[model samples]
Target: MGTVRRRLAGRALSGSLALLGVLLVVPSLYSPTREMAVADREHGSLLSHQWEWSWGRVRVAGLEGVELRDQWNPFGLAVLVVLLVSGLAGVCVWLARRVTWGHVLGLVTVGLLTGRVLTTVAERLGRSLGEVDQGAAGLTVRTEMTQAGSLETVAACVLVVALVLMGVAAARSTGRSTLPAKLPGTPAAGTAAAGPPAGRAGPAGLRPVGEHLTTAPVSFDDAGAGGGGGGADTPATAGKPGRTP
Candidate 1:
């Protein structure tokens, strides 16, 4: 039950990351235009300036038409790449279910794709700390990060974090039933089974069980009977060898 839950959680997180990348790509694809601010014109009326942000282009418009334009749209290409990466990763994540290598592969794909997206947005589109307004040559200009660009940057960060965490979760939940690895020729658990056979040559170089004995432990009476008589001149009658005279 626990394993199933963990697998589901990991898959959900991976899918969410992919979806986030796609969401970031959506706004970049559309490239919406909005009014930045209204400035004073030569007449008694006010003039509105438009800020156009889209994939592959950005432009500033005044009363007449496009006054300034910048074609340096690195964010668009970056987001598109992230989109594709997210899709590929999502597929890998689903297909490789319960496989450690698959999870790792999906994470790697996401890592490669989203890693650059954040940097691209920060370097190209997200410049101002907040909104900035400046006046030059009787024209007022407002500079700020677009909503879509901000979202893209945020989504990239989230995707990276999600992939890292997913890897961790998978690791923790793995090998629940597997036993600890042991070296070759290791004995099984139990004192009797692990010990050496009785009394030949014990473990750790211990001596055998009765190595000092040269004869059987026999009584003097039994020895006399086996000798055919209880004679006084018998070897047993001479008493034990270690006795005092």
Candidate 2:
């Protein structure tokens, strides 16, 4: 028990160190756009502008427009979300067994898609709250929100596929059971088995009653003085050269 505890402790310490290392490494890899966006939120009024427009047309049932003209918080929020998801993915990978690598990988992919969806939600909320202003500088602006080049459409499809795969994999991993390769007995199938062999006991119960059990008592003199039959005999009965006495 002590040895197993020590091994687990060591592994946990190493995993923590690796996580700290990643915390130190990721920011250095971020793109300049992310940095500038973060800067805009902190030092500029980009975060002060958010706007949404709702217009109806005879041909269109519902048309919604969002404008983040000066909204810069999206960049910072995106970076933060990415960092968080990356850290989560790392932790998931660490906690996962090697045999479940595919499941873990799928989980991380699903998380990425979910994060993107969350980003879209945040942006939509910001726009709805009138945190931005919208207008055309010179040319006519498209007031309709059903543009095909929007990021939301891409994220929606990705999220749908990722969620379906995640659901399938998670169901298989949690809703079913399979035996290990070594044990070939029925008792090894799962936890719901009869008690161990009658004579034997598990870690929690009585030991077996057998010849291997020691029930005899020994006095100090008999053990120390070596006078009992259990120890060496006198010289006469010890042996004749190599012959048995």
Candidate 3:
């Protein structure tokens, strides 16, 4: 009963975790920019040249703007990053269950740092394109846009829930036996090499007994003795002898 209860609890936990993951995973894909792009494309509209960002000249007279601003979703980005990092962590934990929470945290931290670096690089590249020459003013606008927190917040919330679920799932899956079975000191089951405990003989070790016991000599010894038996009252004659031979 206890075993069954534990299994049921674990299953429930895993199910909840998976549900959270689904919720979070979806938000990462929810980029408002896609809708904005579709809208722009559908209308065959172009960005107003006067309206620009940190880089400036957002649109040419005849050229269409890519609506990069509309695509900006801080919450979505956060969720996406969290989902990706957690997924990678989960896979690593699954493949090598020895991984600790610190390991997973480190991975997430590094991933976030790398993402920041990339975002900075992108921002720099955007500036180089003369799209955001307004400098501080443009940066403020971009910051505000990123912080608007609507769709992006929802995505982030989902992502956070998913991450929590993944963490719980991973925790439940961790144990000594969860590690790769090939590790040293771990037994390789169902093979002859699986011997007995150290310093002890196993079943196969007793085969020597069968081979050695069969070679016992039953013949009488004392070949050097001569004229020792004094007829039927001899010292060696104790049991009844047939025909007194």
Worst 10 residues of 1 by lDDT: 41-50
Better of 2 and 3 by lDDT: 2
Ordering by TM-score: 1, 2, 3
Q: Number of clashing pairs, model 2?
A: 5
The sequence of per-residue lDDT tens digits that candidate 2 reaches over residues 1-245 is: 77546544543443444344334323322311111111132333332222221110012121232232332345545665565466556545644535556455545644554565455445544543542323232222222223221334344444555455445545554544463655665455455466566545657664555646444553344454556674553332222355322
Q: Please write out the lDDT profile of model 1 over residues 8-52, one tens digit for every residue.
A: 777677556665665664665555423355565344233555454
Candidate RMSDs in Å, in order, are 9.4, 19.7, 13.5
The 10-residue segment with the lowest total lDDT in model 2: 53-62
The TM-score values for the models, in the order shown, are: 0.52, 0.30, 0.27
Which candidate number has the best TM-score? 1
Candidates in order have lDDT scores of 0.59, 0.41, 0.40
C-alpha lDDT of residue 214 in model 2: 48
Which 10-residue span in candidate 3 carries the lowest summed lDDT? Answer: 30-39
Please give the TM-score that candidate 1 achieves against the real structure.
0.52
lDDT of 2 at 129: 55
- Error (Å) of candidate 2 at residue 173 is 3.0
**Reference-based lDDT, residue 176, model 1:** 47
**CA deviation > 4 Å runs, candidate 1:** 1-4, 32-56, 66-79, 82-87, 90-100, 124-126, 130-132, 135-138, 173-245
